[model samples]
Target chain A: MRLWRWIVCLMPGLLSAGEWSGYAELQGRYFPQDAAYENQSDHLISLAFQPEYYQRWDKGNQSLLVVPFFRWDSEDKERTHADIRELIWTYAGNRWEAQAGIGKVFWGVTEALHLVDTINQTDLVENPDGEQKLGQPLIKLSLERDWGILDFYTLIGFRERTFPGEEGRLRSHPPVDQDHAEYESDREERHLDFALRWSHYIGDWDIGLAHFNGTSRDPLFIPRISNRGEIKLMPYYEQMRQTSLDLQATKGDWLWKLEAIHRSIDSGSYNAATGGFEYTLVGIADTDMDLGLLGEYLYDDRGDEATTPFQNDIFVGFRLTANDVDGSELLAGVIKDMDESSWMFNLEASRRIGSDWKTSAQIRLWSDIAEQDPLYSMRRDDYAELTLTRFF
Target chain B: MKLSLILATLLLTPAVTLAMTAEERGLEIAKEVDSRDTGFHDFKASMTMLLKNRHGEESLRDMRNQTLEVEGDGDKTLVVFDEPRDVKGTALLSFSHKVGDDDQWLYLPALKRVKRIASRNKSGPFMGSEFAYEDISSQEVEKYTYKFIEESEHDGIASYLVERYPVDPNSGYTRQQMWVDKARYIPIKIDYYDRKNVLLKTLVFRGYQQYLDQYWRADEMFMENHQTGKSTLLTWKQYDFRSGLTDADFNKNSLKRAR
Candidate 1:
């Protein structure tokens, strides 16, 4: 706490002049069904604070941004964490650009799954949706041409993915023992990585192609007996190579998206793809609300051997936008297994309460889990959550 | 004898314009308007939007706008939000075209992501205000067909009333009536008619200002909805032109870095 205060106090002087902005959120979760594992809680509460500082100079050609995040969970020790989300300095030239420091980058265009998004590790303890990510240290360079934009990155350090603790509401059958993690590379977390991407747009289509060679962001877990003779999941990281393609086309009220990836490990290789479309009916029933229907198909060649549950699945969703002063929106989706009877359903709604405050609610339900399914452990973890945020 | 006839014909063209069809006269007037606004190059401004409901409760939104003129095409524009703290640092980028749908992308600061949005919602409200997407986009001469209704007076100034029909079938309004100032060839007022051919809204332009001694821009735009009893007022300031903005400043990368 003293260190945070010192940095906040000295930032204004060290940076000359900068602006501060961010938010504080309070979240509460309640589980309706019984816990799927022992030592789990049925209710949980958390508070998170993220503050950002930004400054620009040299006619907006150069700038620096800093974002630090901290959270406290009432039930899980692993969920109580703090980290820097972004601390990057950028320089924009006429045709070339450079950036250095820890930052976050997202690269994919799909609704059901993110097959091509592998720049940063997921911060899963924060949310089950896998949308939150940890910051990565890197140096990047970009060139802008008439044809497209090309980017090169040299990733410096690696960050491990976070999982729910034993006392957390959502967890695998056997809790993960992060302290006893193993890595295939001798250098372990110090493994260096590299990536390159080219993106362009033509008429109504936007396209991106990328390649990454380094430590895989997704880890394979192996069950092991710990020192106390208790069974725990141990994560193993392996080095791999991946090439991906993402495409999106916007035509009238319809948006078509696709993401495909081919990854090769030391032993074998696999392929995965997700493709979908979202069509909106504007001004439905003489009102200003928009109703959008989304459908996506997910496929993985590994089938039963895949670590993910989306080997052969389909997702259908609805998105409603009120377009009112409060910026109201709702999204509900269902993901069903094609081979099994397992399914997952989720609903999320949010709206601004006033000028600075916003409220959101989410519900997740799982049903009819098969023993071979990856999500069988979570069949009893149905939960509902509410969050209120105040922004500065 | 040939030279004398050519001279006579040239002299009669200006006065005998009444002999031309209404469509021809309207197209000529539109051409004049477009010609007068040719060389702006680029511009930047700050705008404040005031939205009021039927109950007279008001809300405010503040944003900054930048525009770059494209030769033989429509303009490129970027709008970044500043006020209403929750939406700060959010931005929208658009590439308008003359004959097809405009391409648009929205930047969400919280997620640090840029999403390509469908631009077919031309009649939807912008920022919960009475202004629709089409009302704020770049006006190209090819987007509409016009007919001259009459030459009359508006607010003590000489004006020409022209009726224009949208070329795109997806447009919400069937037609719009515009009053062009005689001296400046700028729009002074516009009445939007719904698909049912009924007057739905009226927009009045006030506080006209000229920049670079050639471009005329309105400082205030007031729009009122007749059936809903709602209104929106837009006030603009700090109009800077020729700011040297290039294509590099309006791309996906730029949208992510917008502050």
Candidate 2:
């Protein structure tokens, strides 16, 4: 089935008047865990086939790009699936432009928090116990100008609640299992966000700033609600208020970024809920800074009971460029969880295989130092996994 | 016979000594080359790249077969790629304002769709090569600040060397040094620099052919990466200007209609 799609994509360029382009990657990995858990590893294969067609209008004064894409992943525990990555239509004139589509809307600068780093079609938040949560659908719009860009988006039917053990189910579970049917089902509540991003180059620096509000589809959550309230049955829809500020600076090969997020939630429900405003700060530094070191620090002032111990984290890493190639890069880093006092070390290497092909491999090992606490005892299951991937 | 020979030599010496300064002559030659090539055109080219790793492993790859049609003071270009099965039929349409901004579009085959390539990505490498998207685009004289370096002889040909600095902040090249043939006013070589003003790559041109009597084109061009040890060679088979092609030929409708 996959092979046929690729052939069909190539046919337009070969047999008709359209063009086609695509890329593919295959990767295998092995995992070794300490005595606490069984060692397990899996191989992954991912492919993206994209083909676009352009139709010129009005004496070559304007044109439109109709690009659709299909992707597949072998390691998807749910099932092997294919869907569009970017389906956007653009109308461009001399000075004005408009686009409408469902594509990856990259709005942030931090690599881990909001930089659109995840390659998986679905958004997954990996918990300490290795569980994953999926993402939601979004409708995006944008207007660009010579000075900067103005963008707005709203995820109309935000549904993150999945069945407890039905890994392959795409539909919602019974109402008995959900506290709020409107929020849990894929038909109620709207996650709206708007941002104004400005980018300017001054001397050798590429500076950018952005301001946004709303809940992020990813797991980089900021705390909301103060510790002063003692109520129950919190409204899930009211927990979605968040404001984010992001700043990034790049000079030469170095990059520095800082993000501060504030959230206000109606936390009057649940035993651990404190209802006020919470703030989190995160900072990231990359090899472009100095000596090929990449590091990050994050802090949340929402109290130890409300925020996870790993919420306060500091890590440093190094990136080495291959001597023979321009884009090949190797990155290694060790992160220390300030709250749990645990540590994680990771190494990744990537190279451009061909004009459109990319290959990469990564290995990660984690350990917990605060084993005295029962909650942190799982840290003893330190493990490592090596993954090899190819991108088409 | 000796007296006649001395007189002839003396006369030619003064004539040679009346030449312009190196800086003045270099600028004049650079302008001449730019003027001769300023027009809407169509081109088809193929490229091959040889890539080597740090441990001496080598691989040969066919990069791309590309066709470009330009219009409107060269501010807009319709580019098509026709090799490497994956992107064999991909087309890119770029529109640039004379004074303000530029927009780009890419048509993919699988989805039967067209996507807008974000403009902010102009600084990113093109297909992971040392060259950025902007590097492959047509360059306007107003985009750079030029200074005459010197007059030098290269490969037995007298050339004028000129230094050029990018006027746009988003440009990947901080500076470039171009060697122009003195008589033909055609660029034969160029050295590209990074943001730090360090030499990053060198491009060499050969197989020059005269077109339209006044225009000169290089049939072969090679870009060598000093840092990566990789090189790409481009060979142009056909280049036609004012071939009665119009804006209608470069539109999105023509993309699916391209051969």
DockQ of each: 0.75, 0.09
Instruction: Give the TM-scores of the predictions, in the order they appear.
Output: 0.96, 0.58
lDDT of 1 by residue, B1-259 (tens): 9999999999998878969899988888888999999999999999999999999988888999999999999999999998778899999999999988999999988777788999999988998889999998999989999999999999998999999989989888999999999999999999999878899999999999999999999999999999899999999999999999988989988888887
Off by over 4 Å in 2: A1-27, A34-101, A115-122, A125-136, A159-239, A268-291, A303-310, A323-327, A352-359, A369-392, B1-179, B189-203, B209-217, B223-231, B236-259
Give every candidate's TM-score on chain A: 0.96, 0.62
Q: What's the CA error at residue B226 for candidate 2, in Å?
A: 10
lDDT of 1 at B60: 86
Best by TM-score: 1
lDDT, candidate 1, A1-392, per-residue tens: 99999578545545678899999999999998988788889999999999999988767887889999999999999999998999998888987889999999988888778889888899999988898999999999999898999999999978999998889877887888868777888989899999999999998999999999999989899999999998999988889999999999999999999999999996469999999999999988898899999999999999988889999999999999998888899999999999999999999999987678999999999889888997888888899999999999
- Residue A317 lDDT, candidate 1, scale 0-100: 99
